[model samples]
Target: MGFDEVIPAPGRAWWSPVDQGAFVLDPGTVLHAGPGTERVAHWLRSTVGAATGLLLAEGRGDHGIELGLDPGLGPEAYRLDVTGQGIRVRGGDPAGVFWGAQTLRQLLGPEAFRRAPVDPGRREWPVPLGTVEDRPRFRWRGLMLDVARHFMPKDGVLRYLDLMAAHKLNVLHLHLTDDQGWRIEIRKYPRLTETGSWRSRTKFGHRASPLWEEKPHGGHYTQDDIREIVAYAAERHITVVPEIDIPGHSQAAIAAYPELGNTDVIDTASLTVWDTWGISPNVLAPTDNTLRFYEGVFEELLELFPSEFVHVGGDECPKEQWRQSPVAQARIKELGLADEDGLQAWFIAHFDKWLSARGRRLIGWDEILEGGLAKGAAVSSWRGYAGGIAAARAGHDVVMCPEQHVYLDHRQAPGEDEPVPIGYVRTLEDVYRFEPVPPELTEPEARHVLGTQANVWTEVMEDPARVDYQVFPRLSAFAEVAWSHLPAPREREFIGFQRRMVAHYARLDALGVAYRPHTGPRPWQRRPGVLGRPLEGPPPNR
Candidate 1:
């Protein structure tokens, strides 16, 4: 069983025989059997193919196969044994066999398929050989792409979707509306896309002044385009949850339909791009017409996206406009509400009831946690983990996307040389070190924590390459955190995992991804040696 003696046979062709007991690993290479012949054969071939490819690339000729399966194997169980004969993956389910194949692929180097001498005791493949009953850790591991701030083209969206699928991520939250642009086409309100989508001015740089350009900058996804994107994501098992910012971030909507505004002022031009980082003044007028308008929009949204959950953005909505408007005050009196927050809550509850009747649940940002959470609504905590904690405590489902750790747009480092502003410095190690479930939660309450997501706001991320630069490495870390539970932040196990990531990066390179390189020490290495003492400040400039 010494690794150095085995030589891989590169030109071997894998074959499966009708007898459910044995398999030809490659031509004459025989692997002693299992019950699921077809499934095992598929696993063996794929693993051998991948491993062979890896070995050939690495200039190593090592090859092997091993099999160990007990009787009464459940549908989920799969056992992979690697030996000199080749790798044999036997599982009651084809999927389990496929996963075992992936594990084997990971063991072999990039040149595995080519004939090469297996490194003997010098390199040992540590394959965990035990019962692993595994499944997805979260129902929704999502990444939100804010298309409205700056519209990303259709092809770019597809590329993002592919990346999500590659990491086994399951949700793509499309933020399709904002004060700057309305991205989804509404046929009933053609102007929503035609006029509201286009902007005359776009602010440039983090601190740059708003550039007033004569050129109209705008684009939107047609209904047909959305249908295609939805179908594409569906094939990859990724749901595209569309978000339409309501009650607030409705400036673009208001521009499209002036009647939806509290003021009859015709001079209201939709913001080209927001200059400020916080809430905007132009919010949806709390009037009967506004409700009817959003109802129509939601009807169109339901037809386009078949996802069970609809995101109505309820974040960063300032109540100044509503508080100052006479019509809003009248509505408040009519509805017997206390203040603008109550009015905002009322608006959200209306959609909650509307979506509920159509067999869909409403999802909103943590801002919805204000006033009161809508019954049966799920909260996406972006401000921090406290919102998710509060929601779970109140018997509500939550997605733990704390900005401190999960905001992908945050600069990975604190150095001013970073591309984006340092919102909250979340290095790849920070992301990898995250634990989705808060430590303070009780076992039963923890069950309410649904999953985690990484938000790419795209305010500073204008170019697709920059997006890739920000997402990868850190995203890989978040992917692991979302899919499985790992040890504590400073555990040596994580350091070991980080070392293994070196190989994973090679695979990413082979896949032609432009991922950021991990250049820092593991989290354990960076722990403060002495408590309550500030570290030396950055050396006084030169």
Candidate 2:
């Protein structure tokens, strides 16, 4: 038998398999067992029944059934061996089990399992044997959800987690704070939720218009809620990395606590959200009281999240406030800083050290690359690939989430058909063609490329349906890019993957997902019908 014949099994097994009769399965054939053995066994029976007349045994084998687990590896290793009287699976993690199941499905063939060889590779049939080792190239393949702009309910978060788990992604970066809203609840500061959580009026569409509805819009996640979410992710082996934008996108917090602002001026009467984002005069105070306020907030966060990485947003902090404020000027003078950028660096260094002491590594947007890069800081390159390149060259671990390729909020094509302002046009083909690690780096420098991420900024994604529409197919493209390695873009292989996506879309529909339709050419639909039709219109919204 060739490598194409076997299927991998799914789920974690504590006991190592005895090398009596084991064979490597095709990487694509596994099926995830999910959570436990009961579920795994149930899926195995049903899936086998559907594909072949074969049915799995109800319980652990009388012949001392055993499976092994390698936590350091990914889910693709599940392997199943069929011979003489019984079948046995090697490796028991849900992912491993799932992959094994996929191989089994393939072995069962397009017809029912009634045709399955009772003794595969007997005197007449040949069984292929080989050793296989597999692992992910990137450690932090992730997706960032900007829920602060538009709150997604708890159920929505779980659904997103399901997708993340299915794709073998490891991290879910929750953008919890922004100028629009403060999404996480702090018991000490009830006003942060009660007042700053909602806005009286919201800006509708890209065009600035007073088409305002009086409905208040906003919500926050309670500590209990976060605990539930964290546990849910852990079971799926996905880490939930929380991002609290500091110093810069802090208008909502300022609204809740006016004392944190530089000036005593209050803006309670302002009903609309801030139109402009970059540097604002009103930033977090650099005073001892301000530091204490943030420390209390982070203390609460540290308790809720168990992830080793915490994102302290150090992007888009303008130097205008530091230049104007007497206190900021005095701090700069006292600290003997060079300029406002130095002050910004000082703020980040402060948090970087603080987070380090608490057993957490600080991850910042690429802007932290400016002024001075902090030691032991991980960089998320969102502005472009240049930032990621810079970080990698400078000896920092980098997650390549360039707005050009990984920003899921951006439109997939150029047209009025898109949901948000077009920033970068990225088709499915374009996404499939992306390489997270830049070729410019040497082998050692390239090793610094941690992984990649798809960011969904919900500013224009007001509804969950729109959210799904933007995320789906593109996310699938990114999933393969993150998990599987291939030579440069092969149009045929990608098209085959797209055919599989059609089936995936049906599954998503059954699950009540509102994904965007795939209107491009099918993977198998290659005739010399059309060539090079240039896409036109605005870029995608990120």
lDDT of each: 0.66, 0.66
Give the Å shift of residue 28 in candidate 2.
26
What would the per-residue lDDT of candidate 2 be over residues 417-475, giving only the tens digit for each residue?
46543456888878888888888889999998888998988765768877887887788
TM-score of each prediction: 0.76, 0.78
Q: What residue runs in model 2 are displaced by over 4 Å at the alpha carbon? A: 1-58, 62-67, 70-134, 207-210, 264-281, 490-492, 520-542
Please write out the lDDT profile of model 1 over residues 1-542, one tens digit for every residue: 11111111101122232232221233234333345444444434443444442221211123435444443444434555543334555655544454344444444443332233233222333322222333346768899998887788998898788667556577999999887788999999998998788776555433222433345566899999999999888755678999999888877777777677667433355333343333567888887888898899999999999998999998877787777788888888999988888889899999999999999999999888887877799999877789999999998899888777788877676645455343667777788888888988898889999888988876655567667777887777777777654556677255655765776676566545667667732222111221122212311110
The all-Cα superposition gives candidate 1 an RMSD in Å to the true structure of 9.6
Prediction 1 TM-score vs. true = 0.76
Alpha carbon deviation, residue 446, candidate 2 (Å): 1.3
